[model samples]
Target chain A: MKEIALHMLDIAENSLDAGATKVELLLELTTGGMLEFSILDNGKGMDDETLKMTSDPFFTSRTTRRVGMGIPLLRQHAELAGGGLKTRSEKGKGTELKAVFVAGHPDIQPLGDIEGCWMMLAAMHNDVNIELRCSTPKGDFEISSELARQELEVEHLNESALRTELKRLIRNNLAAIGFTDGKIDKTILNS
Target chain B: MEKIRSLADLKKIRDENNKGVELRKKGEDADKLVQVKVAMATCGIASGAKETMEFLADSLEKRGVEAVVTQTGCMGYCYAEPTIEVTLPGRDPIVFGNVNVKKADEIIEKYIKGGELVDGIIPVNYETIDSKE
Candidate 1:
């Protein structure tokens, strides 16, 4: 993927396909020049064998195709960025995928359209209670679909205008936390 | 760039938008509206499917087309990335391949609004998980 946000999104889709009703994504950027996300989903998880083979690009749980590259690509990206991916799951339980990356590394991908990422997740899957929790060294912020729905008094979250509003909302919150695109401004965090 | 840390701020923005709540409420009768599904798998995103999805939603909303545009997994058409499925009311879903922003708009205008078929359709020959019955 060209961006970390896309990778998160791709992985989150797997969670949705696994019958996840609630997905929580936590993105944290620390002063140590590390960025990571913990995507936790309440869905049908995998057995030990399936989880082990997830790093192999050819292994997939879906019968749609013979190849599954989402997890493998994430692992490749994480390793290239001087970090790695860790997944823990159990059959009939849920799954938690944590990927860490050296944000300042040259191979590290840009965080493309973080707001757009959240917007797509919320708008596309209205039945799913998706939440984005962003934590920086300075402070923390969260964007929740349920709360936004209640505040807006709108039933569906897929409104195009509402997506525009959501993008602006996410962008402003990230800016307030000293994050521009994906990288956080260390100077601002210090102040 | 105003800080939008609270949900009330979001409501303010929504209320300020030109056609916000009423139009959203109009979509409550989902079965009566046009349905759009964008394929957003790994290959699709790499081929700019996200942009197509966003554009379709925006264009549909601007044209005031009562459509529910949602994202779906790969339609097993990775060779033709960025595919989409359009389902008019009480109609079977037709899959279109290689859908960039331009193609998505054309689909919206021609197939969706005008009820005309385009050239990028990949005939749905494969069976789905739910089709095994």
Candidate 2:
């Protein structure tokens, strides 16, 4: 994925496929130029053997194809961006993945279109509850499917007007939190 | 993680749980149910296909419409990203382009519900594999 948000999307998909009922994603950008992205899911987690081999691109539990590239690709991106990937999983419990990167690193990819990510994921997996929280120098922005559903009085996140409202809410909140330029600092790379 | 070796076994389990909700059935004709295919390729995602798909799913269910919504790869219509192909029972599938939430609502209300075609129909330039034979 060319964008960090796309990577987050792929990881979220994996969580959903695992029968996750709730998933929480946290994106934090510190003033020191460190970007931390984490996803925690309550789903059927991997066994010790599978968890150990998750970083391998060639290993996959799916019978459809031979390779599962989500985690491996994320690991590659993190390493290229002067960071690392960490994962913890326990059988029948859940999984948590965290990737850290330097915002000013030349190899760090752009965040890309995150509004699309939230809209798509929330819309598609209405059965799964998602809580997205991001922290930056400005403040913290948080959104959750459960809350959105309750506020809108809608049974599902895929409702047309509700999705629109959610999109608007996320965009406004992100803009308020210094993401108006699409990144923490546009001059970070130039510096 | 345990490997899913037998797709048939998985289907059996799913079928056991999704008695009436299952949209597609073995040996069933396409005319038996409303079928919707949303483009979900990279371009489509970038162009808000995800939002369009969500609207279709939510509205259909809320209105008590029985439809099987699925995703498909690019249909060589990058210019018309976020496109959808809706096939009402016993009718040829119609492809609509540039579908947003509003367009999706119109589709659900005017076209899918009332059987009246609306705007944004991308003329069918090619035939699908299923339509060929």
Best by DockQ: 1
Number of clashes recorded per candidate: 0, 0
- Fnat of each prediction, in sequence: 0.46, 0.03
| Per-residue alpha-carbon lDDT of candidate 2 for residues B9-115, written as tens digits (9 for 90 to 100) | 32343344345343323214646778999976545665777668767877887797878777775665667878999999889999999999999999999999899
TM-score, predicted candidate 2 vs. hidden true structure: 0.65
Error in Å for residue B91 of model 1: 4.7
lDDT of 1 by residue, A92-178 (tens): 889999999886778888777888988888877768888898877767788887777777776667777678877977887887776
Question: Which DockQ-derived CAPRI band holds candidate 1?
Answer: acceptable
Query: Who wins the TM-score comparison?
Result: 1
After the best TM-score superposition of candidate 2, give how far the Cα of residue A97 lies from its true spot, in angstroms. Answer: 0.2
lDDT of 1 by residue, B1-133 (tens): 2334676687687677646355445456888899888989887887888899889988998997888887888777888889998999998889998999989888988999999999998887666544554
Candidate 2 segments whose C-alpha is farther than 4 A from its true place: A187-191, B1-33, B37-133
